[model samples]
Target: MVKRFGRTSFTLSIAFAAVLSAAGAAVALPQLSNGWPYAPTPQHTDRTYTLAAVGDIACEPDTTENAGNPAQLKCGSASLGGMPAEFATARQADAMHPDLVALLGDEQYEVGKLNDFEQSFEQAWGGLKMMERPSPGNHEYYAYTKHGDNEAAQNGAGYFGYFNGHDQNGTPYPQGQAGNDTSDEQGWYSYDIGNWHVISLNAECRSAAFGNDCSTTGNGVLARETQWLAQDLHADHAACTVAYWHQPTFSATTSTADAPDPAAPGAGSPEGTAAQAWWKLLYNAHASLVLNGHEHVYARFRPMDPNGHFDPKNGIPQITVGTGGEDLDTVATSGGSYTNPNLVTAQDQAFGVMNLQLKPNGYTWDYRPVQAGPGFGSTALSYHDSGSGTCRG
Candidate 1:
């Protein structure tokens, strides 16, 4: 059901007595039927609609004080990146009234802790007055991977807690119930929007092991998401599929040179991690788009197969808009799997977001940097790169 709530328009300052009176502070979050993730149901708002997708924000406060240990960088907080700044970026995205804002992944950096999310949601991206469908990043699995802890065993309990608690009114999501099994894996979920069928798969997995072996599992290229993709794709031929995750299977940035090992944790090369698996499933099914971050830069590519081969016959176009004002990385000049001749556009040194116009034909992406605002000192003209195949409205 569609609903609306009210909040203080003006930032309020609590009086002395108000501080102590705040003892019983409580908020009601959304109540999910099975207590997983959800949205406010897509309301018909005319046929013309706009949607936005971004992730790998790794938003953190200005100071590094709250950062987790350096070892957990894969899943820990990036205290270096300011959360408030990125919040402003999201605010701009809100101005467009995107029909549905798909959170690509790595929404919070480091350990995907609730505290970091609190700072981010309340300060940044809070301008959006609706629901957000988020995908899980490798950072979301930090606690579990780093220490093999049970706290996150239940689908990132702490991360869920942060989202549930941060919700202002009874948002109806958590419904006060907490998760208990990482095995539950609600983070890798899916939903529909407009003429699109979207999926958020976890990127940390190679074949995405259910337990210890890949034989009985389907995490990465495994049968789990693969099977899901088949059903969802077969369910609707016209419905475009858009998939997102924390890291891109293909990143030409210097930072991702040490891509994780798919065969063995810490042993796999960056050459073919989850991208290989993703390519097989998405390319064959002809998914319209794929999104990624972790590169700290903005880039979009022409439709291509898993081996970085340009295959217009059936390929998934990808966008790396990890440039949500987090620290930027330099572009790499490496060749082979990391270098694809089919690159439509690439600006490794810039920080910006890429927007796609999902029309009836092949799509077109416009890369707009966040700095174009105030400090940009008056800049105009957005960047555009037309990919292969027909992606027009």
Candidate 2:
């Protein structure tokens, strides 16, 4: 694998299963020989499929919500500042023909309005919608509170509406889209792809005000989801397992991307206890990998145990791939941001996609950046990271 480093400075730029559902179905994705601006010819592997993953995508300039009220606005151009990166990564994934696309979260920008998904995200990623297995992000939940746009989201109404088979405007959900028909509302589910049990989680607990704890005994929305997660893990016996969501339990950056109010006193605290609770369960179960977004950058930690200690022999690896198509954030060289103290690799430059080549007994991961261009704008497109690991779940 090629390694690119030393140019730390750069401008920021950049699915699912049914509730307790089994995977016997196949999704037919659009075929594209070569279309992306900087498309990379994916390496061909016989019987070794790939799962493409990235998050924090799609930017829309429109401010009107379904209620005809103005919505919360973020800094994004008509191109969303990350649209090119989004399309480029989508094109690359399409060309690679990944068996599944795991969207960590924040598929739509600035409050995740339903129209935004249609006008911006769907337009670029429609080709892979059917193959997308997604988790909800803070944007999806922001509408519930004033933090989003002061527009009533009815607790992520637009998000659940769209993924549960309808647009917020009541349009039908695209056919063959990921997520179980019954549990799309919660945005959590599990399915198997070639002996790997993949769980898509809803980690916007604070945004949803679910609870501080992710235990089944807790009486909150997060508890319910965690309970479901436990049950899902108990029921499935896959040798390799991966769970993904928004908001990482461990962060390499010091900034808070999902903060409810960064200006609030103590608002920027580390903010991963809830996720840590989920991690406890996963650790006990020997989960192989945990993927997340919401950091606006890419960071991969070494396999870590429940206590956030390195344990490559028996711990799960957590990867934050928040660079799907949004402005980037810097990795922490000090303690100002939430410093995890052990980041195996990280980058704040160039938009890219992580390809997880899933094999029967192990998997290989490659985070390939888009080719250098005005789109990347000297954001270190040469940054590349790859590794292979055996299944521990």
Candidate 3:
């Protein structure tokens, strides 16, 4: 006899039936033709993987700004009361034991010098270095002036050296990981993780040391990167794809406010606008998602086409998780109201990491904020968001 049970009671009924069958009882189970009891075919389980991502991390060790003030937006601010905010987030990522860690960008503060990374970022996230797939941010190329004017700009030297290992002949920069910025390579690569094809692009092509032109028509780093991306997508055979970089084409923060204003759309960064070509390529390839940092907040956008129109069946969702211990920024406001119709949800008050559970044909994301220590008196401890989506394939 075939029996149907309510969702809540189905598990119990299955257990009872299995027990009766194991005891060799004369229970009338679902049967096929002839005299044999029917057996259900086992379902195939898809291999799944996990990735932890975040950026805008690691305060400069020498920064004295807000030395012990956890509430202030400065390098020395602490999280969980006593721990450095960056370290707290690192610990959170470590606990997840993810298969991969995507360092969105700006892994180190100031100019991302090798020493700064060694002194600050390495102290916290070093354990995950081997598994990290990194992309360079503007800070890695050109940032605050510690040496003199633009002289302090390591031009991706520090970033590549730290990730790809320093050169043996005393050359400051290395040529692996994201590749040297001084060359046409410009650091764009793709790899497969489980059933997903992951691409990491460098969006800081506008840096003076690289190629100042990010325009689609310019024959610069951006152009070369886009050409490489087109080829990469053409060669990809994965059912699902995700691309990540430093800047975002769709920002969660507006110009007026630090957070997204419901009254208006986000004013995306110029670098992001330059990446529209990338969006077009990925969209044509039916990419599933885009991950980004640099906005210093966590924001999730509804799936949208390259033109920024909602396209549930064909659009790609972009998740910006820049809350990697750097000070968070408020969403931009228009007329004192939050707008940005494309923005689904955003949080700027917390330092956290985003955990992505990647499946064969779909994925789920969970944004977990660092727990505040006793008497921390912060709202970050309460912020959380999670959702699942199917692959466009």
lDDT, candidates in the order shown = 0.49, 0.63, 0.69
Which candidate leads the pack in lDDT?
Answer: 3
For model 2, residues 87-116, the per-residue Cα lDDT tens digits are 877787777677778898888866776667
| Residue-wise C-alpha lDDT for candidate 1, range 306-378, written one tens digit per residue | 6666767676677777766555565555543434445556664434555555544345555666553222332
Across 151-240, the per-residue lDDT of candidate 3 in tens digits comes to 257677778778877767535553444544446656666656667878888888667755677665434667656655665666667777
Q: Please give the lDDT score at residue 319 for candidate 2.
A: 86
**Candidate 2 segments whose C-alpha is farther than 4 A from its true place:** 1-46, 63-80, 144-154, 167-185, 207-216, 255-271, 335-339, 371-376
Every candidate's CA RMSD: 12.7, 11.1, 16.5
TM-scores, each model vs. reference: 0.68, 0.75, 0.78
Report the lDDT of model 3 for residue 266.
26
The reply for model 1, stretches above 4 Å from the true place, is 1-46, 62-81, 143-155, 164-182, 206-223, 254-272, 334-338, 360-362, 372-393
Clashes of 3: 14
Ranked candidates (lDDT, high to low): 3, 2, 1
Predicted model with the maximum TM-score: 3
